[model samples]
Target: MRVFATLLRRDLAMLLPGGRRGQSLLPFLFFLAIAMLYPFAVGPDADLLRRTGGGVIWVAALLASILPLDRLVAPDIEQGVFDQLAIRGIADEAAIAIRVLAHWLSFAPLLMVAALPASVLLNLDGSTLSIVVLGLLAGTPGLAAIGVTIAALTAGLRGGTALAGLLLVPLATPILIFGAGSLARPDDGGILLAAAISLVALAIAPFAGGAAIRAARDS
Candidate 1:
């Protein structure tokens, strides 16, 4: 229990904005940049902006989400943190699960909050804004898990950041579809589906990341 707490705290500190390595503003800024520039590029069509805004937000969120993956696992591995954790009898699975939680905490809430301003910028109405927020809440955890897993797998490779981003895009596509799709639909089914996918990703990430870390260690 103590070990888990310690690790979780450390991970949060490292990944949270203004922490040692957290690119908290970078992703947030990138997300805002997309939103800010979008209206200019497409011209002032209020109806068009409202209609397509949710999807644009989803795209921005997805791209911004990947920006931090490069630092996810590689830094810890380089600093021998994982090796030390293993030596102390901590399971890699447990470590990774904690990281997933930390990773999600670091950005998910901010992304949700950022959505409010984005909604204003994009001219999204109340109901559509609600759908966007709900969808992001349901999907961001899955995105975080995928980021961690990809980061772990590509920790020591050259161009690993680019590879991780490329790998993440495909895996995150379903979440994007379901999450953003809900904005266009009348029901909550898409959000439910996105939540289900998030649960699956959350369930699988620890094992997948653990295995990748083990492989990296052995190689």
Candidate 2:
């Protein structure tokens, strides 16, 4: 537990350095801005806003989550941290878990925070807001897991951003479907199904990503 906490703190310190330019703050704010613009561009009808809020929020969350993938492994790889971890006594599985957890920590909260203003812009009610938050909580882990895999695969590649999106979007369709479906009918079984799928994805993706990272390291 202490090791995990130390690793998380260390990674956060490295990723979020204090400076005039906050590294991730801009991108996160940009995501929020974009999400807020959707309802205005569609028109000012409250019903339309309510109906579309789920899809808009889900789509924005997915995109926002994707934005951080390129940076996930790049800095560590560039700084030789990846190489050091590879040769260190720590188990590869543990290291991969740490990396994935750290990535989740950095990216998921930003997406959730961004979602708040978006919900308001879309005129989401309490139910929709709750659904959106729950879906994000359930789905973002899957996003991070898949992002971790892509980050590892493209850790050394030049056009990683495009490649990561190409690889990720297809895999992320199920999550999008479930997440949006949950919001569509928060009272129905759809939301539960979505939550179930998200939970499954959350459980499965990390193991798959960890294996992929280990294989990538070996190759």
- Each prediction's whole-model lDDT (CA): 0.93, 0.72
Per-residue C-alpha lDDT of model 1 across residues 1-219, encoded as one tens digit per residue? 999999999999989999889567788888989999999999989999999999999999999999999888998899899999999999999999999999898888888899999999999999999899999999999999999999999999999999999999999999999999998788999999999999999999999999999998998
Q: For candidate 1, report its TM-score.
A: 0.98
Clashing pairs in 2: none
Question: 130 in model 2: Cα distance from truth in Å?
Answer: 0.9
After superposition, candidate 2 runs with Cα above 4 Å error: 16-22, 186-188, 204-207, 210-219
Candidate 1 deviant stretches above 4 angstroms: none
Count of backbone collisions within predicted model 1 = 0
Q: Best by TM-score, which number?
A: 1
Index of the highest-lDDT prediction: 1
- Cα RMSD to native, each candidate? 0.7, 2.7
